[model samples]
Every structure is written in C-alpha cells, then in structure tokens.
Target: MGDSIIGGPRIYSCYKCRNHVALHDDIVSKAFQHVCSGKKEDRQMMTGLHMVADVHCADCREVLGWKYEKAYEESQKYKEGKFVLEKYKIVKENW
Candidate 1:
C-alpha cells in the first residue's frame, strides 16, 4: 500500500453540525463503520459518475461526502473499500 502523508493528525468535523467524524489521515475510499450511510447511486459533479453515496456524521447526521459503492472505473476499485472525505463539508482541526 502506498500511503502519502497529506498532513499530520487532524480532527475532521462536520460543517453543518460541527460534529467530529474522522481523522485526516485515516480516511480512505471505502465504507467505514459508523461513518457512512447505506449505499445510494448519485451523480457526483467531481467524478461525473453515478456510483457514490453520502457519508454522514453519526452524531449530527450531516452529509460529509460519498463512498464508492460501485466504482466507475476498474482502476477505482480500490476506492470501493474506502470513504472519500469532502473538503467543503468538513473542517480540519490540527492537534
């Protein structure tokens, strides 16, 4: 596995409810326990594909981002097993 350091440890909080959901470095491209809702196909502006679902803050129920339920591309299969964090929907707190 190739892991790139985006940054140091940071707390990711929901933009709407300010509820902490995940850590910066811990996020992947797949579903995480307690961090994502059930799979739903939706058209994403970023990916321009219909294979994502909303991730939410378990406590506040704020929409964070989408996880790949079905990968649009074969190379994106790795993303099928992780959760993609939306930069606009979350706030990062450095510790």
Candidate 2:
C-alpha cells in the first residue's frame, strides 16, 4: 500500500511564544543544549527510566515538546537520538 494522503511542507512554530521551532518536512528536531529541569526551566522526566527533556522556545520559553536522551524500548531506539515536536504546541504554516 502507498500513502493515501499527499501534503505540502509545513512550518511549525510555538503557539504561545511564536518562536520558530521546526519545518515539518525539513529539520523536525534539534540537538539539546543547556537544558535544565525545574519550575521555570525545561522539564525533564524518564520514560522507563530513559531520560527525556521537554524543550521550550529560546526567547519566550514556551513548551514546545521533548527530546529523548535515551530510548525506553529497544524497538524504538531511534527516538533516543532525536527530538519529538508536540503538535498541540505548534501551528502549521504552509506555503
């Protein structure tokens, strides 16, 4: 079977902070840098004890989504090395 839906490229930005997060068809996740876990900072958690960090806008600091520091399941090990963008926190812009 082939993909039933065909769509154009999407640009995702933070809804609260209006910061450009990613281009859906392009780079989806960026590298984690200087992330801290606390009330005012990016929240960090563990999925089955695998570290995951919630990312936020650099300027306005709105919660965007999370980046997996380690993979919880062996089958999903690829996610361990990348970021996961939240759909609810982003707006899609299409050209």
Candidate 3:
C-alpha cells in the first residue's frame, strides 16, 4: 500500500505538501473527515450496507478514508456522517 516516504527510512509526509505527516506500517486507525470532498455511493462493507463518500487528501487527491453518508443497519447508525481517514501506523525514530 501507499506509505509516506520522505526520507528517515520510514518518516511519512503528505504526498503533496510534504509538511504535515503520518506514518503507515500495517496499522489502521480511525479518523473523521470534516472537509475535503468525494462522491457518495452505496457499498457493501464488513459491517453491512453503507452509503459512503470517499475522503481524499486535499493536498494529494488520494483516497484517504471514507465518510459514512448513511447506514441502513440500526446498530451501525452511529457511524452515519462519521469519517474514517487514511489508516496509518505511527512510528518513532529520528525526527
């Protein structure tokens, strides 16, 4: 998968800005999207049917995560309108 690699062997930064950063190493963390934009569609996920919009990095235009447009399942209702940004694993080293 795509990972930030602006030197430091594993230091990750925005593919475009290269200032703000995040790390990727098989760890997936959840995030919410407040801005940026993507199209919405119904997609079958592990949880169930979800109407989601792909959240892309404003700087890179890369699909980062997703925005839950609507959740059909009652239990999953809490996820509605929530965001899950690009999954990443943070690493520590020379900075």
Candidate 4:
C-alpha cells in the first residue's frame, strides 16, 4: 500500500468582528485572529470545528455588513497603513 497519511484542515476565527473563515493555520496568530472571527461551532456530528461567520456590531448586536476573517486582516492593514481597501478580498457581503 502507498504511504497512507491523514491530516486535519486548518481553522481560523476572527476576534473582533466575530466572523469565521477557513484558512491554513500556519499563519500568525495576530494575523489569524485579526483576520478571523466568530466561534467554532459544530454543525451536526462533525469531528472538526466548523468556522462560521456572523455580522453584528461589537458593542451592540446590531445587524451590520457581512463579516469575514479576511476583512479583519484587511481592516487592520488599512488602519496601520494609509492604503486602499480594494486590494483585500471581500468574501461575504451583507445586504
């Protein structure tokens, strides 16, 4: 038999926006957390944690725009440097 190997997928969660996005865990924690949000909730009888996304205000649970881990990173980068926002990837968009 060939070399049989098994590996788990990397999960990411945003800290501020509470949005969940799946990406390689090899990334930095600060970058990961800044880019990912939401809690890792189980959807049905799953073995791994399913990173989900949620849109709401930080102070209040007010319905806001679409939130994702990628945006988290974009926001941080934008704030740090006076750059444009079109470069970042907008995964999800809320009405």
Best by lDDT: 1
Residue-level lDDT of model 4, residues 1-95, one tens digit each, is 11122433443333345454333442322233223224433232122222234433334343332232222233243222111111132232221
Give per-residue CA lDDT, model 1, range 13-94, as digits (tens).
Answer: 8888777777655665232444657568756645545477788788777777766667776665666646777789988776
The clash count of every prediction, one per candidate, is 6, 0, 0, 8
Give the TM-scores of the predictions, in the order they appear.
Answer: 0.66, 0.62, 0.59, 0.19
lDDT of 2 at 24: 55
Reference-based TM-score, model 2: 0.62
Candidate 1 regions with alpha-carbon error over 4 angstroms: 1-9, 28-34, 42-50
Ordered by lDDT, highest first, the candidates read 1, 3, 2, 4
Candidates' RMSD to native: 4.9, 6.3, 7.3, 16.9
Q: Pick the candidate with the highest TM-score.
A: 1
Error of 1 at 1 (Å): 18
Candidate 3, pairs of clashing residues: none
Q: In angstroms, what RMSD does candidate 1 have relative to the true structure?
A: 4.9
lDDT of 1: 0.66
